[model samples]
Target: MNKPLIAGLLTLALAGCASSQPDQPFSLTVAHINDTHSHFDPSDVQLTLNNKTVYTRVGGHPRLLSYANQLHQQAAQTEQPFLLLHAGDAWQGSGYFKLNEGAMNVDLLNQLPLDAMVLGNHEFDLNNQRLSDFIDGVTFPIVAANLDVSQDSDLQAVENLTPYVLYAFKGDKKKRVNSVEDAGKYPVVAIMGLVLEDMANIAPNIGQAQFKQELVSAQQTVDTLTEQGVKHIIALTHLGLDKDQQLAEQVNGIDVIVGGHSHSLLGDFSQLGWEKNAPYAQQFTNPDGLGISCVVQAGKFAQAMGELTVNFTLDGQVTDCKGTNTLLVDKVFYNDVRRADKHRLTDTEQERITGFLAKQPNVALVDEDPGLRTYIDETYRPELLQTYGAVIGHVPSSLQHVRVPVANQGSQVAPLVAASQLYWANTPEVRGVSGREVDFALVAAGAVRNNIEAGELKAGHVGLDILPFVNAVSLVSLTGREVAGLLLETINGAIGDDTHAGQFPYVSGLRYTFNETRRGHGYLANIEYLHQGEWQRIIPDARYQVVLTGYHASGNDGWHTLFEAQQAETDRIDLAYVQDELTAFLVSRLSKNEQGAIEVHYQKQALDCQLPGVSCNADAQAFIDYVQARRPILTALPESGVTVNRLH
Candidate 1:
């Protein structure tokens, strides 16, 4: 796009420069996906078709691969440049990640023909070593200009890592490889990466690697890229949609942003009965008003992909842009995908839905990539089944996990998880050694990964589906004032920005009202604690033991107060892993009443139940025991109840 530079290169051949004619518009088709997690199988989605509410399965890696391959083949036939870019977050969420870690992800992702990918925060969940191994397995280059991994011992050896990728479009035939950028000839475009700088604050065990500020890194990278004669730029970012927009408005040279994080679906899905206000390939005018940057993101959990087509002028300006963010569906239909009896959709209904989907360009009914499907079915699928296929508890209703609760819609699972932690802490064995009872249990919303549906639950459902991170439990002693500080710190940290709301705390045996209008410590009021058969206000000077994940105890993910409270060695107690505590809590749920109904009595006062001679192994087995013990599982909040108020 640097016309003066291009004009001076009279010896340059225009073979791969979009088109042979000068001043012609260059068309680029970018099929992008972000926050895919590791769901290998199809995810069930309910839709209204032919005036009937019906269910069908959509997305998965195989389906995504199938559809993306088609797009690439079509682009090649048409002689247009096409790129499949992943914005980040390709780890965690399912049993595949739990059993195989990054190994399976590496193998499966190696099958996909992606040109480049960005590093997501979740990629650091295991450690720098695991991330390095994953990096070594993949064929695509990771474009992350903002992150400095030189300090991490394992990541230093990664060879494919780069600040950006340059595509010369056949202009430099001799220097075909991307790493050695043609210094003289102008490349068609440069794709770079920018992610959250405070990644260590959010993800656990990121090692010594550090990330630079998103906006600053982007501008610097763009400036550097432009200096090298690559005027057209695409920022492959993992900073979510809001930050992506901020980058576009602030950075002048970036012409496109394919982003992840925030898990936002951008595009019109109104034809499918929802989302008219969403932005798909939305273009924002640059700060200088000289050009525009187009942005797009796909939803989470391998559910969908965003396909964006942009026509760029010779000066790196977006002339026209269009795209779709849609779920790639298969033909299979079910009444309840989670339950044992799927209640397959009638043939007539499937036909009707198929006919309806055929009319919508924003959606696709696709098949799985045969190679990927065969590998998953034969290798990882059986391994997952062996580890996590047993049926656990049966949920009576759906419990959604909303990061920042809004009007009558708060997390129904976080409190349950908190209660589980309390039960695990109060177990006779654990409490006897510590000689202290846990007064309250608190959990961060970010830790709860998924929702619980009203159907059959599997062992892996909690271990892999919900709480996938291997964070250990921590028992910490803090004064009432300090406890309040931790709560407020998390509240304000996540307030207004849902992106950081993973730090928002959900508690058991505690209640408080948060008035957003107040300043400093005044935002929260009516702080109360559950005493013996009473709801009492917490004494400011009193010391109480609290249960929390080690991540939060160490003050990760905006829980600054928790970090400060545990400065001394005596201030903290390391218990079992959080997965262990949750699994044990499920076992405690087996406490029954004389009336033969499952007693819901795992509160502060109630005894943490244990089998006379049986010990439920942490993570999956305990959940299985509880589920098998109590059919059609039911749960309610604490007696005085958990209260979360945001009066803004």
Candidate 2:
């Protein structure tokens, strides 16, 4: 906070009080929501309200509608104006959207009285025709300052859609009715919307639309809205939290930014003051640098609603801000003092949303012809069961499990995938590529997200529960030197002892050694790439192929070396490549077998032999101990070879 500017505002306020002596304060309420992503169903989310543990079931459209009505009523009682604004991504996700092409959620959203809503990345999941159809169903305006929807025929159907919406609310304080000539007071509020630029990159095939820099688009909208004689400006932003903060800092005319995408629960107010010409070409308009702004996000899955209260003087300058971004619970009766039971939902509430599909339109379409929802649900279930042979693996309850804490190194999950890759490679289809059965598969361990159960576990049970993220695989060719370089980078990024061979790439056909003490810079002094049970020093320019997830290939979390290596190969693979080729290859092999099962076994090589002079060592027994003790960890990996066999 700039103390000098605040002091100046205080002085101005005191001088105004001394002159006019204004008696009343004016306030209005803005209720906001974002990243709902079609999770209209209520969620059991925990919150700390007034320093008390409040278990509130939040965010169902019906529940939200009911709460909005209640809040509107309260506002009416207090003679204050209330506006409901949705930040973005009110569509997509869940079985509901997949089943109905997002029309069901659009219908429900239309029922609510909203001032305006912004477009999010997921809104473009379907083509423009479907998006336009959904928008046609909505009663209120949808704005996107950045997206050029004009080029699309379907999007152009919504003629009334504006880049920014200007709302006029009656300000507090009764006007004198002298001589029947006095007019009623009215306060105009302006709202604008903007989408992030990265939508083109992330949601590429969904829509061929592009978004401009968030700050630039917002500035343009501000100029337009301000020129129309509206002073108070609120921005409905779909650009995530970080971008929202940058907007707050870079954009001058914006008063508050209701952001989405990243999914945050923000209650604290953020203030930014103008210091002459701020960075990013922003020119200050507010006098005395007293301008205050805030940015908030109400997580994903419609789990929360954000409400804000701002007070402005008759002169159109905001003087104060109060209240909070309260996340209203769906179950209203739970907080009722008169209720005998603490739980709000009657048995009827539980079943209420479950049968909502019956009343929803296009339900028959999804039921008859399921889309992505059906494919994903069907694909994962059967495939998970076939990957790991054992129906269940039991472990002690006390064993603790977790995701790989390190970024580049192999995790329990990476090794399992590496093992599966090796096992799958020996199949006929892949064997043809190398003209050899196969030797091993190497995987970095950092890809794992969660831990497995400590107790008895099943094959489908573990893989399904553990590796839930939908990531595509990419296969790349590299030389022996490149592999060694990649291994060096991987080892250097590891957290624990690197001398333990098991700690390196979870390998099926490869073995390597590293000196823990010497494994800092130039750590990987030497490595042996194993093929068909024979170890050989890698040739610098020799072409070697390896498979990894698209995320790793893209190097999103900063595996630049891996990304560069993949780029060097120029063999970029789509997600469908692995799903269809490698997965199918494994399935075909498993189906022909009598038992239809694949076994994953691990054996640790002693580091003393590989590391030579280095004393660092972990024997086969030690590795077995690590796997058994960390069964929860070992099970976290994605198991391969689940198949759907047609019964003859």
lDDT, model 1 = 0.71
Q: Local error of candidate 2 at 318, Å?
A: 2.2
What is the total number of backbone clashes in candidate 2?
Answer: 9
Q: TM-score of the candidate numbered 1?
A: 0.76
Worst 10 residues of 2 by lDDT: 583-592
Residue 354 local lDDT, model 1? 84
Model 2 TM-score, all chains together:
0.54
After superposition, candidate 2 runs with Cα above 4 Å error:
1-25, 44-58, 171-185, 206-210, 267-288, 328-648
Q: What does candidate 2's lDDT look like per residue over 1-648, in tens digits?
A: 000111343334333332221234456688777877766555443333333322334555655665566666677678676778888888764445655667766666765667689888888877877777877777777877877766566675576456777654443212111111111123456777888777765563445455677777887887776665456778888887777777777776776677788766654312101011111112223423666566666655655566677776654456655444444443232322122265454666434432432342211101111232243346432443354345333432212222222322334444555555555444465455434443344554544423333333444333333433344444455677767776666555543443222223445455565544532333544555566657776677877666555445444433446555543235433222221233211110001126732211112221121333431111111222234444433343432211111111
Clashing residue pairs in candidate 2, if any? Answer: 387-640, 391-458, 392-457, 392-458, 393-457, 394-456, 410-445, 411-445, 440-509
Q: Estimate, for each residue in 196-265, the C-alpha lDDT of model 1 and write its tens digit.
A: 8888777887888888888888889888866755656899999988999998899888889999998888
Candidate number achieving the greatest TM-score relative to the actual structure = 1
